[model samples]
Target: MEISSQIPWSTIAAVISWYSSNIGVLLLNKYLLTNYGFAYPVFLTLCHMTACSVLSYIAVSVMDVVPFQSIQSRTQLVKICGLSVVFCFSVVCGNISLKYIPVSFNQAIGATTPFFTAVFAYLVSRKREAWITYGTLVPVVAGVIIATGGEPSFHLFGFLICVSATAARAFKSVLQGILLSSEGEKLNSMNLLMYMAPIAMVVLLPAAILMEDKVIWITIEIARNDIRVVWLLLFSSSLAFFVNLTNFLVTKHTSPLTLQVLGNAKGAVAVGVSILVFKNPVSVVGMMGYGLTVIGVILYTETKKRYRL
Candidate 1:
């Protein structure tokens, strides 16, 4: 009873929410892009941003879920817009990779995010981790290399794009931390997402139009023929909002490093689900590599936690 009383139920709930939303969006995305033949990654990402913009407004302004925050200055608005660009790039590349790679392989690559986060932290904030922490990243890199060599359906283009997306994600995380670290500049997760979503729409619009061409009309036609596509898109967009919201909540309740550790575990879960659902071919080497990455991430997290003490 005493141990139960000490448990942080709220934080645990937030983490579960984050995992469900993250995995749902990811798997749905893979289904839409690969199996469903919706190959327009940019347009799909644009749809996601549009959903986020509308849903975020409804939640904040209409439902009063969280307190609304207004942009205080031009500088702050610019920073939000800048962050939106990176966010858009990260999301689009991630979606594109789904078209070419299995989700299990993608998750294996994603487990390396902590390594990129460490590098970006130093480059952006001049913050350095302990030597032991840096050493733990060694296996993270080795694991990805092994996973890459063992990927049955490895596409170089896909691998490169996935890696870029991972790096961009880390950079965005670090940049957000630094850019909004100030008390005056800080906006709660919901508000930050609320502001960034519309900006992301603006950024994604032209890219979708130029690169994807008439894919939007194709998506509409498909939706008209099959209502399931519409339902899928709607569900995916809603999940995306929850992903961002729960991500912020988790980080708020715990810490960013905790988020990273949870994320690594989330990657393992995603890998298992992807293999089960998609039946993607996997080799023993690939699984071993992914296991190594997970272990490295755990060590890295522990090292950071102990160093802080």
Candidate 2:
């Protein structure tokens, strides 16, 4: 297909929406992380999933869109559930990392997700990557190490969690791509969000209830007192649904590598917002790492001549 023909307006709109939502999510997530604790993850996830599910249900009902249906098979249901579990864990770890690290650093480090995704795609799907893609990882990795000042003493556990989260995110993208491609249909973000939100909510609800010190009733009471929390919850929920949906649309429109590159840009945007809006601290080393990461990403993009599934 021609380049213009390949570009889907819906995908473009989804990506723009994703970026806008990321800004809101980063701001709200930073507040929750700095002020509250990991509990914010559970709360944010539940709120967003619930809101998206409700909205999706309304849209489907009003518009007479695709009806709620079972997965094509039991195996598919199992895979979706498994992927959702991994997604939940990844997001939780990512949220936890924000407490110990600057948003920019987190985004910069997380940029490695594209590299990891490319590698994982190669290994898992037997897809071949351009030789330059491997070379591009060197600077990306170097930048992350330098950006963190090679510090061994600063929130080692948090850093590790973030790294693991990035890896899991990369894996999730690859798995999502495989599943979506196998299905062989262009699914709108709202449709996919409708299915995944309720399922993920079901999976996460039990754990949030059991592990969270605050019960549902108590949490609701607290939310009543802290109206900002309620607003944040709503914003976060909308953002989650939009972001994931845009990501899927982008993957369908462009190549996985392209989507990964865009993801890195999203991270950088988050970093910028964290510093400017939240007054988060940054180091000279972190700045250098950020610069190098941009350079590496540019190199990868230039060298990449083809976009494949």
Candidate 3:
């Protein structure tokens, strides 16, 4: 399918917007976690959730981006709660992964998300893709394996959490597609976020309090000592809010597969930026690995498009 012929300019704009926020948040959060010494992943995630909640409220109840709709059915409420669990799990794990690993390595692991997504999708829906499409995923998996050998900083625990994070993210997307596609319970991104943000916030609070509240107090003192920390954090939170906006916009305009493909491409961009900004060393082998992953991503996009998988 020739996407250009069918997708409206509005959709293209949304894709660009999502890309910007996704990339921006990755870089910003990494800076905060690694360089700036703001080591509160769960709490930081809560901040993002809180900001998204506030912004979503303003967008809906105040601005009327999409009319506020309440969840009336117990069934729908159950579904959203289930999604919230996965969503919160994925996001927290992601933040935790980034905290312990280099941004490039973190994103390299993340590039494998589509494979997990495909697996979860097939398992959940029992819908099969063409064998060729399945074949295309091999390169994606291979690339991640190759990259692992060359990772400059590989923490085993961090890598494990990141893997779980990737899987959870895939699960969330698959569930979102299944649960939200129903017309009767359908919600635009803002409305979806409005409900989801609160649930995620609730789910994350105990974790934040238990795991981070004590350790995070140190960061509070540090922030007080250096006011720039506060400014940077607030900036990060603001960007985090916009990320939800762009995330919904892209999914509204495109398929989860498209978003997955774009996310893979964004990983390459993120790794390049992280290396330049952080002055991190990338060996020849590592460069080759990164290149392989990106090539696989490109191939996957083409195969998915041509086969309409």
Candidate 4:
């Protein structure tokens, strides 16, 4: 069967959007927190959630990007809140990890997301894939391990937090699938962001304030000193909203496992981009590891197509 016949243009568009926005946000977050001396991951993440809330609201309510979806039941509302909580945690942890690690190494750690996603899919939803399909993940993960060995700036604390963030991300994907599996509970990507973004802000605000001292004042001070910082924040926040939107769209059109598979390829691309943008040193071993990941992703895609899994 032809690939185009199997996959809709909208799904491909969503995937492309996801790749661009995700990479852009990660790079910006790294630059802001580490090189740019912003140094407040939690507060920065709060800004992203705030942008998501406001932009998502305008997109849904005023622009009519998708039909407005009200919380149907107490149960659905609870599920959305739970998702928001996880989303907030994952994003903040991801930002914090970037403060201590290079984006390339960060992507190396993030490559493990497929493993966590596959495990969570089984445990949370009892979903299973063919053994052959599972085999494809080995190279995807092994490549990351090889890349990690090549990283010069590996921090144990950063590595741990990145792993935690990756696991949280995988769990969120599986949880979203389980919580919104019902026909009535299912929401379009835009509408889902409309509800999730604000709730995530509510969940994140207290933690941001408590963990980061004088963040508001510091942000203001930074903005006053350099208007460029303000522009960067706005640009990063806008990218963050698109990141969430495209993520939901991809997960909606495809299974969580496929999303994770795509993410492996994405990690390889991120590593390449980081090298170019930041001029981070990558050993020959790292490049070889990335090559393996690319091969694994292609094999995974072919396996899915051949077996129609």
lDDT of each: 0.89, 0.71, 0.82, 0.85
lDDT score at residue 48, model 1, on the 0-100 scale: 91
lDDT, residue 162, model 4: 92
lDDT (Cα, tens digit) per residue for candidate 1, span 95-160: 999999999988888888889999999987789988888999999999999988888989999999
Candidates ranked by lDDT: 1, 4, 3, 2
- Report lDDT (Cα) of residue 222, candidate 3: 84
lDDT value for candidate 1? 0.89
Q: How far in Å is the alpha carbon of 262 misplaced in model 1?
A: 2.3
Better of 2 and 4 by lDDT: 4
Using TM-score as the measure, the top candidate is 1
Clashes of 4: 0
Tell me how far the alpha carbon of residue 27 in candidate 3 is from the true structure, in angstroms, after superposition: 1.9
Candidate 3 lDDT over residue span 183-301, tens digit each: 88987778888899999999988898898767567767887789887788787788887888887778777887778677776777878888888777777776677677777777766
Scored against the true structure, residue 255 in model 4 reaches a CA lDDT of: 89
TM-score comparison, 1 vs 4, better candidate: 1
Candidate 4: misplaced stretches above 4 Å? 1-19, 246-265, 304-309
lDDT by residue (1-309, candidate 2, tens digit) is 775587677777877887887777767776776765425566566777788788777766566544544356666666666667777777777877877776777787787776788788889998877676668878888888787784333477778988988999989878877866665332445666666667878877887787765657766777787766667667777776666655655666678667757876787777777779867667676788877877776666666555322
| Regions of model 1 farther than 4 Å from truth | 1-12, 252-258
**Model 3: number of clashes?**
0
Model 1 alpha-carbon miss at residue 136, Å: 0.7
